[model samples]
Target: MQIIELNQLTKTYGGARGITDLSFTVEHGEIFGFIGPNGAGKSTTIRTMLGLIYPTSGSAKIFGKDCIAHGPEIKMEIGYLPSEVFYYDNMRVKDLLHYSASFYKKDCSKRIKELAEIMELDLSKKMDDLSLGNKKKVGIVQGLLHKPKLIILDEPTSGLDPLMQQRFFELLEEENRKGATILFSSHILSEVQRLCNRVAIIKEGRLMALEKISALKENTYKKFKLETLTKVDASSFAIPGVTEWTADERTISFLFKGNINDVMKKIAEMELINIWVEEPDLEEIFMHYYVKEDGSRHEHVSA
Candidate 1:
């Protein structure tokens, strides 16, 4: 039931880096999160998958078919919403949607109307007349109008307000329940944390980590900040689980991943004015991955 498969999926732009030896898969009915900062090759990998761009090396398959050789067949089941949407400005929303639907055999008018209503998109408005948010709504409607089997969303919530985003997430969840496989690409950690069952983290055009959300959180790192009455030697806190710390006069903070008892005992020996120990959020963990120069932390997943 692997709907999508990537094997040594490398893409390079001349001498610049794109994705290097990337490999992963999206199984049926799974909400797979593809995460990384901008320029981390999220878009590159996606474009290649969609066959909009050819890879310098490696290959991708969708629905068990080669993406390049059988792109048109594979694309019939995919609904893709890019971060930035572009359309014929002269066409009304209704006209453009109808045009897009023409590519498929079945009638998408009724589904288009339903999606527009759910997204609150004004079908009467010309593409040029809509705001960025409204245009994004149009993109959502167009992408889902055909009731595609696989949804590929790249930074799909960019221009939406909080309420709209909530609604959109609900819509995607509904689609998932209806047996649609989704590949959600975004830099927003919280959104990925909330919706994705499994995530593939990429950095500098390389896969960094791939794990279930539960596993990632279970291995959660703790953030600690302490204000001491006096300065202490940095090496004093160099325990097995403690990462490097940032020190400023009497204040210091670092991330810890193991036995809290050991850290508590060490802190008990210190003269502190105040201290704060809390669970690090995904953003903090994301920064941890970003700063890692070595790829040793990546957990390679087989396709």
Candidate 2:
């Protein structure tokens, strides 16, 4: 089932861009990664889908219903953790969570206690006395207390330590096993690579790439570094499917996207001191979309 849908969804602030012709769908029981840096419309797209803001053009849908038309009903099944969490300074964590649970029309007391213990959150502390990380923990607990079916997380790990981040990922995985769909939006490529089944790369509020994580890593750019016995000719590595080529005396490096054997055959003829061929990580592959063949970044319209 399609859990979420955005068809030519666009939003703009006066003359500025929010997202342009953005389109994608989140499937049932899958972890979908919405990848982009700051001001890339990740938040705007999410907000539109959740009916926080009306779209300037196009439409968004959730659970097979128009988002704005049925927002109240749709939101009941959603668990959302915003990039930044804010709460009344005087409120205790326990009270805040209980208040959040009241909206779901179900008793979430037992679930809240379980989640608080798992998150190692101190419920007695007031919101004003907590650190940024603890505040984020409260957001996590508040979102999950009602056992929502669709979890939307925007940059969820910003304030967490590595250990806490690991625990949070494990918790998410457990929720997935019990049949929850996740839409994880973040600029952290490594986190997306580790946790998402597929990712939709967004830049300047438009879709860049959408593919399975395994296929994206397998078929994308390969980083090749070669050290020759003598000064290397630039033309020697100027084969097709190579971009961002650079050379310094005996060293030559570039990102190759074609057959590995073509490069291996070229390497067999070269007198080399050392060589290293590696798969480009998620960050490198993501940046490749914004890079021109001439090794310059494409100018983006800031949102």
Candidate 3:
């Protein structure tokens, strides 16, 4: 089933862009990745979906109900972790989680304890005394204590250590198996590459590409490596489609995402001892969408 639907969803402020004619559907029980560079309208799109801000035109639905009209009802089934977690400084961690749980009108005590143990959060500590990573832990426990059917996370691992991140991912995977759908938004391509089944990429508030992770890997993203007898300036090989590259005195290595001919033509002009071109990593493929086929970079704009 389509759990979330965005139909021609456009939002704008005075004269600036928010999100324009955005349309996509997130399936039930799937991990959907929402990705874009800074100022790509990712947050705006999410806020609109949650009805935190009204859309100037178009509409959205969660669980088949109008988002704005049924915001409260829909939110009851959602667990959200914002990028930055803030709370009343004086409150103890347990108190805060219980307070957040009050909205659901159920006993989340056992569930809260379970999540706290998994996240390694100290409920005895005061909110102000917790480190950034620990505060994020609180947010995680708070969000999941209710066991909501849908989870929305925005840069949820910003302050988490690597070990905690691994544990958190395991937790998410467990939730998914128990019939939860996740909407994961992050700038970390590796995380998205590992966790998301499909991805929706947007730019300047407009949908760019929506593809299955499998297809994305099979797409036209290639890694190029060159070894030359003589040293060549790395800047000389900076083709329109190459964004990620490393160059040494006699070696230039990079990933390419545009017309094969454009890069091949440039390489033909070079004196090479050995050339290697192969499929790039799935993470690198994510960068392909940010650049236009014409080789220009996507400009970052404020949401």
**lDDT, candidate 2, 66-128, per-residue tens:** 999999999999999999999999999999999998899899989999999988999999999
Lowest summed lDDT window (length 10), candidate 2: 294-303
Local distance difference test scores for all models: 0.89, 0.87, 0.85
Q: Specify the highest-TM-score model's number.
A: 1
lDDT preference between candidates 1 and 2, better one: 1
Model 3, 242-299: lDDT tens digits are 8678888898888887788999999999899999998655345545645678987554
Q: Return the TM-score for candidate 2, rounded to 2 decimals.
A: 0.81
Judge candidate 3 against the unseen true structure and give its global Cα lDDT, from 0 to 1. Answer: 0.85
Cα shift from native, residue 130, model 2 (Å):
1.2
Off by over 4 Å in 3: 220-253, 256-303
lDDT of 1 by residue, 1-303 (tens): 999999999998889899999888899999999988888899999999999999999999999999999999999999999989998899999999999999988899899988888899889999999999999999999889889999999999999999999999999999999999999999887788789999998888888788898876666688999999999778877788777589988999999877789899999999999999876665577666435477445446432
Q: Model 2 scores what on Cα lDDT? A: 0.87
TM-score for all models, in order of appearance: 0.82, 0.81, 0.81
Model 1 poorest 10 in a row by lDDT: 294-303
On lDDT, who's better, 1 or 3?
1
